[model samples]
Target: MSQRLVVGITGATGAAYGLRLLRRGRELGLETHLIVTPAGVLNVHHELGLDRKALEAETSFSHAPGDVGACVASGSFATAAMVVAPCSMKSLAAIAHGFGDNLLTRAADVTLKERRRLILMVRETPFNLAHLRNMTAATEMGAIVFPPLPAFYHRPQTIDELIAESIERVLELAGVAGAAPKAWTGL
Candidate 1:
């Protein structure tokens, strides 16, 4: 059976990562379960020039911000992993503490509990010790906390290239191979 991935996009500024994941994953034949927060919907419109409905139309599985009844909410649904690209601090705290107020958070919790890969692409500046502590706790629970730090070796020229690189990293940790940039041989 083909692998599945949950893509959760929050209010974080870097929304392109999540969108690119869905687009690229679909091309790779991976089923994507997507969830967008209210603010995320607005961000897409303001940033990507796509409205919430239009964005959802392009996804395999899409749900409202706090919709807990989404199909991916259960662990028996079969998934390779979950990716929260551009994860907000609020959602990060939720996942760290096992708070499942929403389907996205709940799905991440279930992924962690199921011993599956849970990639968190946190996108916030000026983080504090508490944030670091929360990240430490989540890491102990098997969630990969990847802040939106870009790499220079890729020699990316446009913003899209940078975002694609980050999503590619998350996909690697999710066990979805062949998604990362070509092997970096020592120059």
Candidate 2:
């Protein structure tokens, strides 16, 4: 199977999720292709203090959001999966509707069309009707709408632990071997 993983970072609050996923993907030997929306850049800098250059350094390849011609925008690119960590509701709407307005959404569209796993770690709370509807649409189109809610069962002592365990579960859903999250045992 192809080892390529496409990761999209949007203008969501939880930029840490995207960063950790990139780091873990590197450790797992996946060729990571990153697409960060302009707002995503701002959030990464604001949340993680990482500039675009520093963030790009985390991945094997990085594409501009406007670069719809990038390799990952095509279904022929042969990526194993695509994930939008901290996916914005706007992005969810675009992907749900096959808008493909930019490289991130285009790659997601391709992932769906190719029958590859597409996980969206959406980061929003107190959803409105539109958010719920878009999520349903994305799910109907074969996208896994994963909200990055922490699992309290893990009894994480640190914020890092919560983020780490959540990301492990996401990586597992992306089909990464050995990316298992801590299993929940019967109480």
Candidate 3:
């Protein structure tokens, strides 16, 4: 698999997931390309106290959300996968309907069209019919709707641990070797 991973951060509440994904990708030696929506920057700042610059610094390269001409927006740009952490419902809808109004969704569309993995860490509660249907649509189109839900099998003590575990699982799904979370050996 290519070492290039494209990551998108939307306006969802869980900006930390995107941040941690970038950090982990770097540690795992993956070249991460990031695209943060305008609202995504707001959430990152509000939740993690980091500005757009700080968030962009975490990746190997950063592209503006509106940059449709970016390398990541092309199917020829060999990438291992594209993951949208904290994917907003709006973004999900856009991706599901093939609306490449911005680079982030365009990259995701390219990933799907290229038959590469596209994981969406959707963040929302009490899903409406539209959200569920959109998720279904995306799934049918080969996008994995992976919500950033925490797991408790490891008995995590801190929020960071939970996030780490989730990210590890995501990385494993993204085809990153040695990224599997701790296995359950049984009680």
Structural similarity to truth (TM-score) of each candidate? 0.94, 0.98, 0.98
| Residue lDDT tens for model 2, 1-187 | 4489999999999999999999999999889999999999999999999999999999999999999999998887898899998899999999999999999999999999999999999988899999999999999999999998889987899999999999999999989876979999978
Q: Which scores better on lDDT, 1 or 3?
A: 3
Candidate 3 residue lDDT tens string, 1-187: 4399999999999998999999999988899999999999999999999998889899999999988999999998999889999899999999999999999999999999999999999999989999999999999999999998888878999999989998998998989876868888998
- In candidate 2 the C-alpha lDDT for residue 28 amounts to 90
- Please report, in order, the local distance difference test score of every candidate based on alpha carbons: 0.85, 0.94, 0.94
lDDT of 2 at 174: 88
Q: Predictions ranked by lDDT, top down?
A: 2, 3, 1
Give the clash count for model 3: 0
Off by over 4 Å in 3: none
Per-residue error (Å), model 3, residue 103: 0.1
